[model samples]
Target: MMPMVLDWFIGNETCETIKTKSSDDVCQGDSTCYNVDNGSGYRCKCLDGYQGDPYLPNGCQDIDECKDPNLNKCEKICENTKGNYTCLCPKGYHGDGRTDGTGCVANQSGGSLIIELTVGLGIGITVLIAGSTWSYWAFKKWKLIKLKHKFFRQNGGLMLQQELSRRDSSTETAKIFSSEELETATNNYDESRIIGRGGYGTVYKGTLSDGRTVAIKKSQVVDESQIDQFINEVVVLSQINHRNVVKLLGCCLETEVPLLVYEFITNGTLFEHIHNKNKASSLTFETRLRIAAETAGVLSYLHSSASIPIIHRDVKSTNILLDDSYTAKVSDFGASRLVPLDQAGISTVVQGTLGYLDPEYLQTSQLTEKSDVYSFGVVLLELLTGQKALCFERLEEDRNLAMYFISALKEDRLVQILEKCVVDGAKIEMVEEIGSLARRCLRVKGEERPTMKEVAMELEGLRMMLEHHPWVNNDESRLEETEYLLGEASLKIGSNGGMNNVTYDSITDHIILQVGHGR
Candidate 1:
C-alpha cells in the first residue's frame, strides 16, 4: 500500500533519518506504548490498579479487593473487576459501602430492617441470661455467709473466744474450727463417715488437713437455753489431761448445733466387748480387770484430780470406749455436770442410763460423786456376770442385774450366777473379793458407797493381787472341765447333807476335788 508521510524536520531529508518500531517490542499486554524521537525508541506504562510484570502475558491480572477488604476500604461488600474494584452495600444496608466514606446503614423500613432487629434482640437475650446466672450464684454465696455468721453468734462464739483469751498462753487449749473446714473434711457430712449415734448426737469420722483422725459429734438439736452449759463443758473437757479420758481436740460452732471433735478411739465400746458373744469369749479375766481398773482410775481423776470436779451423770458400759491396746477411754460427756469446789453435791434433775442409775440420786434428785460409784458398781456386775445391767429375757425377779447379783450374794449363790468365762479364768477368792467390792458400791444409800478414789484403789489392789498371786491349779483346760461339770451336776444336786447346792463354798470344794483327782 502507498503510505503518506509528513516531514517537519527542517527541509525533511525525505524523513529517511527516523527509525521504525513494532508495538510488541515496545510494551506489554496490560500497558500502553508511546514512541519518542520520531519512532526511534518507546516507553511502557501499566494501567491503573494493575501491577507485577505487565510486560508478560497473563502476569498483570485483576486486583481482587474482596481478598483484603481494607485494600478497597469497603464496609459491607467488595466486587473485583478486570483491573479495578468496587464497594457495595449488603442486603440490609444502604450507602456507598466504603469505610473511608459514608459506610453501609440500616435500611430502616422493610424486610432488611426486620433481619437487623432479630439479630440485635438475640444478642440482648444472651447478655441478659448470662447476667441473671451470675447474679443468682452471687446471691446464694452471700446468703450462705450470712447464715454461717448467725450460727456462730448464736452458739456463743464470742464468749468462747473470751474464755480462751483469759487462759495462759502455755496452757493447752482446744482449737476453734471453722464449719467449712469440717464440712470439707467430712465430705459434707457423708453418711459413710458416721461411726456412732446416740441420744445426744451422731459421730462422724474425719481426717483433718494435718492428717489427724478425729471423731466429730454433731448434736441432734440446738438449745439456746443450754449454750452457757455447753461452753462450760468445752472448758472443762479441755482442762482434762488424763490417759483414760478421751481428748477434746476442738469444736466447730459455725452450725446451728455445736460440733465437738475428739481423739478417735480405735476399738469399739466396752459394752460391745462385754456383751457381744463372739467378743466376750476373747476377753480374758486379766484384760477385763485391767479395763475395770483403768475405767475406775479415770472416774477418780474426773472426780478428784481434775481442776474442776466433773460428775459423769450418764455412766454405762456403752459410754466406755476401748483403744487398740484395750486402754479405757471414757467418752460421751453430753450429760456431764461440773461441780464447784465448795459444793458437796449438785442437786439437779436425775439424768442417767436406766440400769446404772443410782436409786438414792433418783429419789432425792441429788447428784454426787457417790452416784458415780453406784453406776460403776453396775458396770462391775456386768464384768463379773457378762449380763446386761437390765435384761427383759430374764425372770421378773432377775430382770435387774444389780438386784439379782445382790440377791445371789446374800443367798451365797455367787458361783452359780458368775459368768462361766469369768469363773473359768479367775480364782474363786479374787472373784469373791471383787463381788464384795461391787456389793459395797451398790449400797442403796449414797453415803455408804465408796468414793471413786477408794474404788479405783480397790480395783488396782485386786489387779495387783491377780498379777502376783499364783493360785493353785491354774490350768485353763482343768478350769474349763470344772466349769462344765459344775454347770451340769450342780443343778441336779440337792442342798441335802454336807454342802448347799451351787454355793461359792461348794464350787471351791468342787474345784479342789477336781484338782485332787487331776481331772
Candidate 2:
C-alpha cells in the first residue's frame, strides 16, 4: 500500500548459491550476509563500529566512534579500529576505562575507599527517599488524627466520657468504637459493603476485628442541637436486653457523621419477606403472627420496662429485621425518643416513614408509645395483606394501605382483601382475630389504640391459643375473651419467652405481669 518494494537478491535465491559464482555479488568488508527467512533471497549487514552498503568492495567504512562520544564508553581515551574501538584509562587512574567493565578509579599507593564511598552514597540516597515518603504519610496521618479529634469534640465525645464515668460500671453497655476499626471492618465503607440505604442513613455489613459479623449504620449529619439525646441513645439501648431488639454493640463519633454498630441479622427485613413475591408466598400466617408478637414485645419493653420510657418514633416492617429463624428484632432507633416517666409522651419534630407514620403524631407532633403502635399496626397489615405501606398502583383514595384496610374492614371485605397466602395458611378465626387487633392498633386516636404492651400480650395470647388449647373448657366465652384479652387466670408465655399472669380486668394496663423472654 505504501508503494515500496522489499529489497532482496535479484534472483530471489539463497546467499550460498549466489556466493558460488565468486562475483562482486558477495558481501563487503565488515558486513555479514544471510538468507532471508522467506527465501526471497539473501541480505547483507555491517558489523559493530561500521556502517555502509555491503554491495561494493570496501563500501563498509569504520565508524569514528572516538568522534562520537555516545558510541564510545571510554573514561579517558578511545582508539577506533576497522570494526570497533578500544578504551584506555587516564594516567592517574587504574581499572578498565569502560564503565560497564571496571570504570576508572584513582590509582593510589594506599587502597582507595571506593567501596565505602559507594555504600555511603547508597545509604544516603535510601535514607533521603525513606525520609521523604515518611514525611508525606506522616502529615496525612497527623491530619487524620486532628480531624478525628475535632469530630469527637464536635459530637460531644468528652461529655459522653464524663457521663459514663459518673454512672457505675455496671450500667456501661455501649462501647465507643474508633473510626479506623469500622473502616477496616467495612473496607472503608466500600460500596460493596453497603446492605441498605434510605433517607435516614446507610447500613453496611461488616466483620469486626474480633470476627463478629455486624451491621454498621452510618447515619446522616447529627443535629448539634440534640447532641444530648444523641449520646443518650447509648444509655437507652444499653439498658435494653431484649432478644427481640437489635443489639447496639457500640457507636463511633470520630467521623463527621456518626456510626452505630449493631448485631447483624441474617434474614432481611419483614418488609422484604412480606412484599417480595417469592418470600411472601412462603411465609405462613403462623410465622407472621410470631414476628408481629416479637416486634411488639420489643416496643412494649422499651415503653413499659426500660428505666426510661422510650417511644420508637419510626416503626415499620422495614425497621423490623428477621434473624435466620425469622424471629423479629426491632431495630433502627434513629428517630426514637426517650420520654420522662412523668410525661406520657414527648413532643418532637415529626419524623418517620410515610404510609406508616401515625396521623395523630403527624398532626400534633406528639409522639407517644401509641405512635409506635400505629406504625406496628401498619406492619401487621402488611403481613396480612402482603402489600406495601404505600403504593400508587391502587386507586388514589386507596393508595395508603392503612386507609384502604380500614375501609375494607368497614365494608366487611376482610376475607376478600386478605393476602391469599395468609388466608390459606391460617385459620379463619385466627386471621380475623389478628385483623381485629390490627384495626384496634390503627385507631385514629392514640389513646384509643392499644399500648404496645397490650398488643404484645394479645398477640402472644393468640399465638398460644394456636399452639395449644384455649384456657376455657370449650366455653362460648372464648370468642368473648379473644375480643378483649385471653380468658381469666390464663398463664401465657411471652413472645420471647417469660410466663405472664394474664387476667381479664376492667383495664388491661393494670396487669403488672412480667412480659419477659424464656420458653
Reference-based TM-score of each model: 0.69, 0.67
Query: Could you say which candidate leads in TM-score?
Result: 1
| Best model number under lDDT | 2
In the predicted model 1, the residue pairs found to clash are: none
Clash tally, candidates in order: 0, 3
Candidate 2 C-alpha lDDT tens digits along 123-234:
9999999999999999999999999999999888987777777778767477889999999999999999999987789999999999999999998867888888888877
Q: What is the C-alpha lDDT of each candidate?
A: 0.79, 0.80
Q: Give me the runs in candidate 2 sitting further than 4 Å from their true place.
A: 1-136, 470-519
- lDDT per residue for candidate 1 within 1-519, as digits (tens), equals 999877332222222322242323434567654444563444445677777665577556566767875667887788888777788997768888888889999876787767768999899999999999999989998998898889888998888988889989898988899998899888999999998988788999998999999999998876688798788789779878888889998799889898999998999899999999998887778888888888888888888888889999888898899998888899988788889999989888777888899999999999999999999999999999999999999989989999999999889999998877788787676687688779989999888887887777667755654564433345545444434544543322122211121211111122111111110
Q: Which segments of candidate 1 are over 4 A away from where they belong?
A: 1-129, 410-412, 470-519
